[model samples]
Target: MITDSENMKQTNANIAEYTVSEISGALKRTVEDRFGYVRVRAELSGVKRVSSGHCYFALKDESSVLDGVMWRGNVSRLSFVPEDGLEVVCSGKLTTYAARSKYQMVVDAMEPAGAGALMALLEERKQKLASEGLFDPSRKVPIPFLPRKIGVVTSPTGAVIRDILHRLSDRFPSNVMVWPVLVQGEGAAEQVSQAIAGFNAMENGRPDLLIVARGGGSIEDLWSFNEEVVVRAVAASQIPLISAVGHETDTTLIDYAADLRAPTPTAAAEKAVPVKVDLEFSLTDLGRRLSVQKTKMLEDRKQAIVALARALPKPKDILGMNSQKLDDLSERLPMALLNSTRQKSILLGRLSGSLSSGKLQQAARFNRERLLSASSRLRPISARLLTEKKDRILVAARMLASLSYQNVLNRGFAMVKNDSGNIVKTHEGLKIGDKGEIVFASGSVAFETSSGMNEATANMPKRTSEKPRPKKPNKVNSKVDTNQGSLF
Candidate 1:
């Protein structure tokens, strides 16, 4: 009975043994149910945000250490980061990581351990970020006079966004993109920073400017804008940013880093754009001034042109001066001609008194007969010289005909040329496929050059197959043969 009892106990213990996953799941459910909303006040350590945007850290005191995680979705609800050594109170469900066989707290909310601690932390961060030049006035971007689109980073359901939209509509209506983010809580700073960066990194149709705004709140309620992440994001933004957190008295770190700061969300909208009515009035005034100035300039130009026209000489006056000079010249022209004719008559009379008319006639007859006899003798001499020159020209013509290329072509010989028009003196430069022309005694033949002397002989059967002979005059007519009809 003792052995059976021990075996039964051992079997019962074995029956209660659980698998790794089962035990993990059971522990997770028990711990979660027991402390579903427990708040842990401890110093944070080993805080790290992963690439996936999930935050993993440890909450520890002197006696205990608890591993904690804030999911990417729930992280946006946090207003401050849990840095190492930072005193914080975190609230969440206790859960287990089944694969690692470990348990951790899934933190959904957090706050600084006390108001004093949060203020001290905020001051320390402000100094650190300032030391890095994040708060330099030189780093601030200039707000555009007119932006096509404006981006708003705020809570979607709050009065802040509605007020900003209404103000923008009243002032200058613009395309407003609302990047909804938690205005306060544990990880709200990260969301705001991410929203800022996302708008900056946009490639297609990004907002021209950004506004980080929120409604009236206490220092704790506005702590998200004071975060290092939020401050750095504002400083590093490519587009100009405006900070409008709470009322005029609620100043945040973002207000310092932004290009412009507003007392309220509505003021931020006003600062972002101009009042439509005021702009219309200014435009109307400018247009009227421009029209008046243009009219004055045109009138001044017209008066100056009239002054210049009056100073210029008249066309009729110029014509009258030219016509009076023409008349004076015409009156002097006849007297000048008469004076010249009288001087010539006096010279003719003096010459007439010096000559004998009968002697001049007799000398003229004698010279005419003598000139007739000499001309008759010179005519026959010129005809005889002409006959001799004709004979000499005939002899030179025959000599030139014998030396010409046409006479050579009349023989059995020929001129061969390549496609480039160079005389083919030898077979040295000939390629097998080279085109060439062969001018024969009768006509010309075009053919491709041969690869070798043997190929040339085989290609031109009648040229090389016949017995070779000394070239003699052929019966074919050439261009030099006038009586012979053209044969070549």
Candidate 2:
């Protein structure tokens, strides 16, 4: 036998040496070459998307797990959002990451494994959106009875749009605006959602109603309508929406969110508008009925008026009866008046016979005696009233004499008056050469104010006698002439 060290040296010499990177590269090449393109059926787990726009997840079953990565380009092409616990088939080539020294799948394409898986995913999504009230019946709006303009979202090149146009033409020609969009496959959901938003954002020529439709296909072909963005857009649309996405047996998330659902594209067109001919016929019929009813009502009123006129009494007969009664009263009126006058005359004659001249004289004498007696009694009262009146007059005369300004003149005072007959209370009103009157209690004398007559001389008392004797003129200038006669 060889020694242990010698054996190890010989084995090392035969084997090639490699660094960590070299071994990793060799493993990567081997994996890529062995399974160049593989299809994997597994359940998704730990699905995550980083800010780099790459999706990283793990594909696992009962036995083992495989790491998976999809670049941004591939991720954008997916029809639905990948979530954990979804069963999917991934198609890609096997590769090894040099840095981690591990094998993984670089997924280029992915889809739900079968119809069962798709149905399960759809049910799960429906439950989630329903819980958020996106599918609430109360949130849905009523479709317009007659839309003036209709907006359609579908593939422009497909039979769905052609069928809608043809059906709408047959029923009622409307303003139909077709928003062409991909209705299936990659990016179809985004296009469909954007078409809905675009219609809503229009300021002019905005449609009164919207119809999202697609031809019947497998679940995968119709999966775009089930996208959350498309479903939410349909639910939040202000314009009433009709979902005609698939056949009668096929349903989508959009069906629950839309205001109405049609079995097919043709059915949606029928619901959008009513037949023009039918509307015209209805209006004509209603107008005819109204006219007939109006005529009947007028006839009934005319008949009622005629019946009322027939039941009334004739005007000539009513007037004739009143005229006869008036004539009877006129014939009896004169006779009645003559009898009354005769009775009054008899009564007057009897009254005159009873009142004889002697009796009348007696009554007059008696009345005369009564008057003389009353006069005798009233003499003292009349004398007393006269005497009292004379006393009041005398007393009033005395009080008047006392309160008179003449009394002031009689008390050795004189009143001076201007030429205008106004009293001059102050000497300041007197000017030299101004003519005025000096009034005494007995008489008034005219005087002229001279420059030499001071206020002291003006204040002097004047002659108040009934007849004043003439005095010699003063040598000094005097305001008054001593020879002036009394004016009273």
Candidate 3:
């Protein structure tokens, strides 16, 4: 018989050996091969995003849980942020984490599982945005009665856009700019949000009103309008926005955030512009009313003038008394003129009798004698005034002579002036070699300053070699007496 050790050795040799990593790797391949891809419905739990942009979460129902991982690229594509307790359907391939030695669903796409789940998520999101005041009534702007240009955000090939154009053409033709974007699938939310912002950013041909429209559909098909980016963009629009995303019974988050909401795309167009015929009719009616009012006012004024005219007396009756008074004055005028002429004639005769030639000559003699007597009195006063004027003139002449700078020069003083003809009051400004003049009563002398001369000698006149001449007092006195004699 073979020994026990030998049997154990044979058994061990018969089995294949494997390392820890090899086993783990083999298991990962087997799981992937069996279920390459899957769609799992479960409530989200422990949803966390790390700094590296990778999302980690657990999908659990009542009794079991499965781990899920989404790479950075896929995480960025998510329409809504993942949160705990949100029910979602994840579409991904099966994979394994070697480090943890656990299997996980490598999520490429995720969405709310059903209409109920989506509605719940939408309600939660609506509450959150509402709390932040994004849906406040005060935040909404008034829609324009008629927009100059209308910017539309919708699919170019859809019926929604055609309906909007048709309605606008019938109501009021306007400039319409279509920003075509995907309405339903993968990147639809991003495109819709960007379209809203793009219209606001236009510098030229910018729309005064915006209409975000899409045809009616299920919640999943219209979920792009409910995205947070799209909703926030609608709220923050500078131009007024009208959301017409679905049929009358359907609603979306954009309806709450938009400046105004219309049940259908055609309704949005109607709200944007008024009917052309109706506006023309209104203008015509207003014009008619204004004309009627103007005519009525003129007629009332004419009637008032007539009433006032009747209250006054007749023109002929008002002038009758004045006319009679004028007639009476006319009758008395000729006789009064005759009586005045007669009285004037008598007075003239009396005056002429008194005024004879002798009386006239006597009056002339009297006036002549008076004139001679006045002339005799005026001659003495005239002579006295002439004597006083001469005396005053003599005194003024003496004072002027005393005050003259020539008199100061005569007392042995001299004045200095700079080259510029300005009086030199002090020697401080006189530099050596500077040219100037010195003035005395007799004459002036030009000279340059020298270092050898002191300040005291600068203003003094040079001495002459001849004897000094004396002043003639008798000649001045004789001149004064001659002036006095001439005045007399």
Q: Give me the candidate number with maximum TM-score.
A: 2
Can you list the residue pairs that collide in candidate 3?
none
lDDT of each: 0.79, 0.84, 0.82
TM agreement with the true structure for every prediction: 0.52, 0.61, 0.60
Model 1 stretches astray by more than 4 angstroms: 1-45, 48-78, 88-110, 301-334, 337-488
Model 2, 1-488: lDDT tens per residue?
89999999999999998999888988988899999999999999999999888999999999999999999999877867788999999999999987776789999999998889989999989999999999999998889998999999999999999999999998899999999999976578889999999999999999999999998988887889999999999988999999998899999999999999999998999989899899999999999999999999999999999899667655444444544554565566556556755765565555556778877566556655765676576567656755665565566556555556787788889998888999898767877777777888777777776655555455545758666555434222324446655342
Candidate 3 C-alpha lDDT tens digits along 226-256: 8888999999899999999989999999999
Model 3 stretches astray by more than 4 angstroms: 1-17, 33-39, 45-56, 60-65, 70-84, 91-93, 316-488
Model 1: lDDT equals 0.79
Cα deviation in Å at residue 139, candidate 1? Answer: 2.8
